[model samples]
Target: DRCRVTILHFNDVYNIEERPNTEPVGGAARFATAMGKYRDQNPLVFFSGDCLNPSMMSSITKGKQMVPILNSLKVKAAVYGNHDFDFGVDELEDVTMETKFPWLMSNVIDTLTDKPLADGLEKTVITWGTKKIGLIGLVEEEWLVTLATVDKDDLKYLDYVEEGRRLAKELKEEGVDLVIALTHMRWPNDVRLAEQVEEIDLILGGHDHDYDVKKVNGKYIVKSGTEFRNFTKVEVDFIGPKYEISTMKIEVTSAYREDVEMKKIVEEFTSLMSDKTATTLGRIESELDGRFATVRTQESALGNFLTDVMVAATQADLAILNSGTLRSDSVHSAGDFTIKDLLTILPLIDPLVVLEATGTQIIQALENGVSQYPKTEGRFPQVSGIMFGFDPEGPPGSRVDPNSVKVDGEYLVPEKVYRVCTKAYIARGKDGYDVFKDCKPLTDPDEGPILSTVIQNHFTAVDIVKGLKPCRSGHHQSLIHVASVAK
Candidate 1:
């Protein structure tokens, strides 16, 4: 018997509706349009994973809003992304139930029960005509540790390579013809799995958002870039007892029109989001500009404001935060900073923390923070209440001359102790600040509480900077800009 099957895949869609500014890209309607066209010619449509959470739009809706749109597109099956657990296991279970398609997570298990956390559907079997397509889903284990929202006690992520071997063996024993490994793990992990696992015919990937299709260790691996900009279509032609992929095409969704029906669904959701976003609390005195290419490289008025808030919130002598944490540097145009704007800037739910450290540890920590400056490291700290200078041209460790560095007009005393205010992310050694990993925690805050709420309560209002002067002193220069109330 001869059979033909096509697998349509897109990773990291992240709630991008097809229309222009009216909505984000990769909306259900737009994806439906693309899926409908393919389904008309074929019968299978598969999403690799990472279709939910991480966006303000998705979070506000608790992922319920995406179900109808995905159902409309006839998404047969999708693997789970790390963000799927952003709201917690219960919310994720709700999303799985609401979704018309089967949400597969072969690597995620209940730590207490040692059973699959998202189980109800078959883990590794999807049929197309007479051919049996084995589908195995893999989520990154590191997500259990990195994500601020997820509770380690509630969930357990099994090793991808080990899970891959176990599932592949089971699927092959069941007379599966081709094995498709849908993963939320990055390229290196996928490559390692491909090399180790012999039965995996294709590795469909997400997470890193790099667009590339390459064969590693005889396995075909494909990843579409983030935000539904593109998708990969793999056409399999079954010849006798064997199946071979005859045609593989990368379809750019941006080239085609958004599906009309899906567009309507998106428009309705967009209207709801807009109405909700209109409730503004306070106003900015001046425009808060955050053009990333310009401001992030130096310092942003918004960034300074956030650091000041962290300092005040912790009542620490100094504060340090990453510029990358400020997702967008869009200048405020004399308007209310809505809840949406705040979420966009600070997407992660990292809580503020105060740590006791000596002046020497402070300088070491600051050096660790600015160590990767100009390169735009996400953990790069934007300081408050304290100022220091650095020379990128000089040696890495010697970049900050002790003579030039100062805290309130005096050289840093290596022996003196200082109370530092920073996000829990830094204290956990997330941003390459391993020095703080062993440091005693002064405060351990809960997740889900908004930092913006703290800012609103502390400061009456914000006054944006206009034509802020650059801080330069002798051979060293301070990267921070903007002014904020001292703690």
Candidate 2:
């Protein structure tokens, strides 16, 4: 006799409301309605993680809004993405407690508790349609260092291929009919796992924000689109000892009606954001281009403005802010800049830190920033007191021209130490800036100002100077320089 089962998978969702005037207006409400159509198949829903922060709404809620949205999905299992731990392990654990499914972190372990990182399950088995299916979650090691709240030294991470092989073998030995690897990693790593791990019958992945499906070593690797845009519906037919699988990409567009309950849930969380949008920060004379296409590819006016604020706020000789820090993905026209616009540009409360980095380390960091040029990677640098040129055709480690490098209008001196103002994320060696890890923290995160707050303060200083708001005695006058530089 043959048995059939269905699987529903999606990943990297951030916003709950529909993106107005955008194609495939994939709101959580519409996504829920779309998934509801498959209920008759008794599909096992799986999520590849990253629903916790970075969205405009999540910025205010600190990801608390994701609890209800996740619970509504009735997810069977999930793997943790890098952004899931953005709030911290403890906060994630709390969010997990409220969710209805099991989260798996098969490779990462907490040395302090001697358990899976975030206390996630290492493996789980469930019976669906007369077959026993084994699930194991896996992630890449590259992003482990990037988790702001997680200390790499305090945790142990195993290779995904090794862990997938061992776990799938154990599950097969336990009499499971099929094994599936739920992974949060890039395409290459998933392909590597599919090739190396024979015991795993299928793989579902996340973290790349692309909708792709490929078969390697007779196993299928699937990645659903991000932000509730699309989902993968996999059909598995088990015939005695073998199984045949097929997948369909289902897009969530305006054609589908929103589920009332889900829409209400979304409205409840979003209504709280109304009051925070009206307070104007200041007026800009020209459009500040914060779109990813501009900021991640090359220096833009928005990048210069933000980096200028960083250098002014921390009084560092130079500043480097990752393009990823600017997330609005849209341009702000020359007009009244509001708190809403600032929050959209910088949703995360990134604390600034001053690092005493050598000129060599600075060069290394700049090289890393341009390593993935033209690919729109987040590691691209937006700078203020430094300038360097890179050849896109050059190799990654040698892209930046040493001769073009200058700090404070002078050529870089390899032996000289310069105070660099940057997000605490970079100081911890995130986004391929490992050269900064060993550098001394000239100013700790505690002593540094929050990035958004600094921008807001700069505007307040501008208002004070314009006599729009009365100034207090001894108000620092240094911030007014940022307004002038932006002009």
- List the global CA lDDT of all models: 0.65, 0.84
lDDT of 2 by residue, 71-118 (tens): 888888899987776545656787888888899999998887788888
Which parts of model 1 are misplaced by more than 4 Å?
A: 19-28, 118-122, 253-255, 278-319, 322-487
- Candidate 2 to truth, TM: 0.66
Worst 10 residues of 1 by lDDT: 470-479
Best lDDT among the predictions, by candidate number: 2
- Name the lDDT of candidate 1: 0.65
Query: How many collisions per candidate?
Result: 9, 0
> Candidate 2: what lDDT?
0.84
58-155 in candidate 1: lDDT tens per residue?
64565566777667767787887765644445456766788777777787776555667645332658777778888888876655543323345557
